[model samples]
Target: MRSPCASCVSPGVVKVLIEPLSNQLAKGQLDFIAECLHGQESGVMATVFKVSGEIIAKVASRLFLKPDGTVISNIEDELLVQQILVDVQQVLNQGESRVKSYILPSGIAGVFLEVIHPIVPLVVFGAGHDAIPVVNLAKHQGWHVTVVDNRPGYITFERFPNADQIIFSEPQTIQNHLDLNSRTVAIVMTHRYESDLALLRTLLPSSVSYIGILGPKSRTQRLLQDLKSEGFLPKDTQLQRLYAPVGLDIGADSPEAIALSIVAEIQAVLANRSGGMLRARFGSIHGEEITCLMSV
Candidate 1:
């Protein structure tokens, strides 16, 4: 059981708690968060709070909730964690943080659920001069970026200092080097006709969320026609995820400006936006504003 006074946290006092299994050693919440990021795992951190007055609330227990319904905390009682599992999962699925009040054994408790998603994985197929700015911008956005090229001289750590991984692989052998997932976004800009064709043949059928190909519409159409002639016909749904002539229409003439447009388009795709002007839309900039949950 958690201590009743646990909720009465003082200002500037850090209240951190975690409990490992009987055989495992204990770790702090920060360490656990680091582990999650390192492993590319998604989870939620739930912090319980006690409503002290009209304007203030105090921190109580904190727990980490995994997608498999496992809870990690020092609280001896498992009932509270179990009771909030459904709500936690809902918030996690929405990919949005939320706060909800609950009627607890002690009193009305507020659980602030923070959704921790994995760092986005971006694979740049070409390590050319243009790809440099793309890699730099993605890293600035805190994405895990991988640079791939068949040219032994091109795929070097010196060339891509900020890249998390630089792979020296051709289009035929690229699949072995990549760990493609739904969260992964790929950019194709090898500048070679055969290489782009081979890469598109592989990427179009995979679960990668977005595939932005750097070329003109006619070039992309020719690649698709060639791919179809090779009997690797992609489904309509797969083609829908393809963004040929990539990047938003920002009149990007320079490499840096083009990189910005590409990065912004990727962000918009992930957020399910159409890359339109925000000033044209009404309401809050980020969809909906957070509202206080009614105390039960």
Candidate 2:
């Protein structure tokens, strides 16, 4: 039997008033998105119900989102769809809508749907042409980005208006300034060996998860050998963290195509995935790796 308010589940229409404002994805938002993955905040709608028998699942995700969270769908839970809408209404009823985190009522879990939200710190080592489009796409994806470049003219706010921080510095000298948590993806697009080599030596030992070197494979191998010769990888830990010749082999030639490949690689890594396609891969997309990860 179909549920009474079936129209509510019509892939339904959700309307909210709009206001013009600048967008900024904050740190708190990232943490919340991660925390939600662990079932840490009471209950969430984490599955996407594909119905063949009937379209029983309904997804409404605008409720739990705060003004900032709403901007990016940080707390997307189709299970919490109506309830979250109710939560928002409650806050709106009280004239407020921001919470560090909150629990949801058990009865509210009904919808079966997939809600996607992700957070990655885009660490760019150079502000080159390729780096520009990548940063633009990252911003469009609502990522937290920090850009470092040797040229002030390239790293200026005018050049990268949406970047959280744009710094002009010696490439090798700037690694000390990076925050290499498990969520970071550092891209070294600098064509100069001095700059690229310096970055490898500087960042190889950090806790970062992804390091992509934008160059030919032959150059990358030679550079890695050079790094070893210089005692940059005198330890096992340093060897394990290296991902030189960054990006998948998508046969990308254009700057944008290369950026696309790099971003695709980063996304795969973030999801603990490989081979570049979901259907082509084996096993579940999210599993123990999803839960036991350093951060959800």
Candidate 3:
């Protein structure tokens, strides 16, 4: 029996894009769409159908409309897809969810676009007391959060009722339990030198977009030096993505204050902002344009 298409599935979707009807596309195009959806924060589903109700082509929101109202994807029907993508992009820009329909020149009337923003995922690498505030702050923002620590005593659901997942595992073994992708924001605050070093070694080689290490700048420098001595020379690109001395310099001393700073910094980074005063910055506070599927 043939599998049902993504649109035929039930209600209440997760942060995933499924396109069972995409077998009509080339393998390379399918791969590109997969990569795009893997990094998107706003969930998107686009289905192209014939007037007879047969699904023709289907794709998710990994493609975004450029400022000039064009898209950069390898999918077929670029013009029609671009038009539909523009409509989806407008909904995302307005921070709303909606279903939109369009008619193609072929007289197909069932072409539809559905877009929904998913909760961002955040993984905290330490379950220390300081992590509580971070978890609380992130949960308040409606982000999917996971907290990891090796000590069973330190990482308990009682301490983190809002956390989606609490894993008790060694720093080196975290990859087995958690999957880090381009949209994941990882924060390391184990407060142990060895654990932080191990986590950094593991994360720097992965595709996780943001790696925030809590501590002093000098501490991070020392950690890098140690990693270099161990023959782990991080690439320039990887080093650039690491945010040492995590959180903004808002004179944060208490745990809650620090949490605020850290979350603010992460939000700014996700939005491609400099975390500067809005009055000093030009253009829209949301950035000049929405960069869909671009690396965080």
Runs in model 3 lying further than 4 Å from the true structure: 1-117, 287-296
Which candidate leads in TM-score? 1
Cα lDDT tens digits for candidate 2, 70-141: 433433444444444545444433322122122344323332222323356778888877788888877787
Off by over 4 Å in 2: 1-118, 234-237, 278-296
State the number of backbone clashes in model 2: 4
lDDT of 1 by residue, 85-167 (tens): 77778877787766666665655566667777778999999989999999999999999999999999899999999999999
Candidates ranked by lDDT, best first?
A: 1, 3, 2
Q: What's the TM-score of every candidate structure?
A: 0.80, 0.58, 0.64
Alpha-carbon RMSD to native, per candidate: 6.8, 11.6, 10.6
Model 1 TM-score on a 0 to 1 scale: 0.80
Candidate 2 yields a Cα-based lDDT of 0.57
- On lDDT, who's better, 1 or 3? 1
Model 3, 97-153: lDDT tens digits are 333445666444334343434457899999989999999999998788999999988
User: Candidate 3 at residue 173, lDDT?
Assistant: 87
